[model samples]
Target: MNAVGVDVGGTKIAAGVVSPEGEVLAAVRYPTPRSPDKLVETMVRAINEVGSGKDVAGVCLAVPGFVLAQKDTVVFSPNLPAIEGIPLKERVGPEVGFPLTIENDASAAAWGEFRFGSGSGVDDLVFLTLGTGIGGGVISHRALLRGAQGSGGELGHVTVHATGPRCACGNRGCLEALASGTAIGRRAREAAVENPGSALGRLAARRGLLGEDVTELAREGDGVALSVLEETGRWLGIGLAGFVNVFNPEVVAVGGGAMEAGDLILASARREIRLRARPPSRDLVEVKEATLGPESGVLGAAALARNTDGAYALGG
Candidate 1:
């Protein structure tokens, strides 16, 4: 039987029908609704569209928030404030009429990688997603590590610098604050402003934006953009070293738009991790890019639903 996976993001909600082998059979997407009620309705529509006339066994949802494993309530999410503390399982359960499992987006992505992507052969792995912000997940011995209070694997909040920059979470010097996509864009904008003659400035001016344009400029050998990416990569490496030392996972999968800069970003991260991490840990971990790209979360969520127990049990 197939499963339905819903990936709820700040901008859009994507639902897909997935097979046990990780192939997506059909997908439906729509802009995320603003209110909590509308969001649920939108999700239901997407689920129905993809699940119609199919033998869907269950549904899995990946949301960006602190989810209570037992209740499937979104305790808090900086991006989706309107849905804070919303009981997801209770709200959508009756409508979908299938066992539903919910997980943090990052965790779902990691599970997706573990079951179907690059981390398939590894028992221990760390997943760092570099999107609007940094998010992370951890797996050990083929099981997820959902720490006390069900908020484990928050790799973005790990402190990399004590006096760096302020984060959206109201924390200072967090890894996300220093090396996220937002951080990269912010730094590139600053660099363009400070160096009007640089290629980055020209690209930003032409594109009317600072993100991918700047990264593209860096790939084209723009000095200012290169510097920004290098700095961002260094911060990511510093943060990754901590994880390397602590978890000693066999593989580290880096995913997200920022990684599209290719060696401009990852090369520096690899260098930094090699320089700072312990010999044994560094030697054991193989840092690589995520192969599933943007589909990892949904694929993983579907995988979760497919593998869940006979009937969906809310909290483990």
Candidate 2:
């Protein structure tokens, strides 16, 4: 069966019709509106545009923040406050003329990886997206591990440093606070200030640095920029170490914009996991880049979409 998946991000909304084999048959993109009503309207339009003339079984929305799956509502989304509290299924289902389900965006992406990407061959997987903020999801024994309230797999919010920076979620020392794209930018800016003679410093003097800028500088062999990424990677490794010990996943797939640094970041993360995680789990788990890139969200959501009877059309 084919299903429609909508990945709603703070900046853009991407919708796609995906086949059971994981091929995206049709796709559409739109700028996300900040207002609640406009957001709903845009989502409906995106779904219609992508699902038109397709044999779609159901539609699933992959949204950020903490989702209350039973209620089909996003209780909290820091990056996309406009989506918070909206009954997404109720708002989008009738207009799209399909059965709908809601899932945490990270969880959906993890499912996408599990079914078709890095985790395809594994029953146990851990997926993390290091974008503006970190998003995480877990698959254990071939099932998505959503906690009792459907808010589990929030790996980013776990405390990694007791006295680290503040997170957008109002927590301190969270993995998101120390290792996300936002965190990289913040660390880069501070590094630029400390090493005013470096390439990173030269760029920061002209314009504010973003995570991408840090990656670019690192690629040019700028020592300060490389150091920034190394530090971020170590923090990421610290967090991954904890997860490796706890979940013992066969694969830990890292995705999103920050991962553009690739091994520059992951090499250190691997080192930290080896140092801190238990021997068996650390030795067994493979930490690698997620292959689907930005498409993981929509693909995962589509894969997880369910029928009217709540059966997954394309099982995870």
Q: Give the alpha carbon lDDT tens digit for every residue of 1-316 in model 2.
A: 8999999998999999999999999999999999999999999999999888888889999999999988889898989999999888788888989888889999999999999999998989999999999999999999999999999999999999889899999989999999999999899989999999999999999988888899999999999999999999999999999999999999999999999999999999999998999989998999999999999999999999998778998874
RMSD (Cα, Å) of candidate 2?
Answer: 1.0
Q: Evaluate all candidate structures by whole-model CA lDDT and list the values in order.
A: 0.85, 0.93
Highest lDDT among the candidates is held by which one?
A: 2
Deviation from native of the Cα of residue 52 in model 2, angstroms: 2.0
Best prediction by TM-score: 2
Candidate 1 lDDT by residue in tens digits, 1-316: 7888888988889899888778899998899888988988998888888988877888898998787887788787877777777788888877877778788888988988888898998999999999888889999888888887677898999888999889888889999998998999889888888988898777667766647886888878888889999999999999898899999999999998888887788889999999999979999999999999889988878877733455422111
RMSD of each: 2.3, 1.0
Query: Candidate 2 — worst ten consecutive residues by lDDT sum?
Result: 307-316
Report the alpha-carbon TM-score of model 1 versus the true structure.
Answer: 0.95
Candidate 1 global lDDT: 0.85
Error of 2 at 30 (Å): 0.4
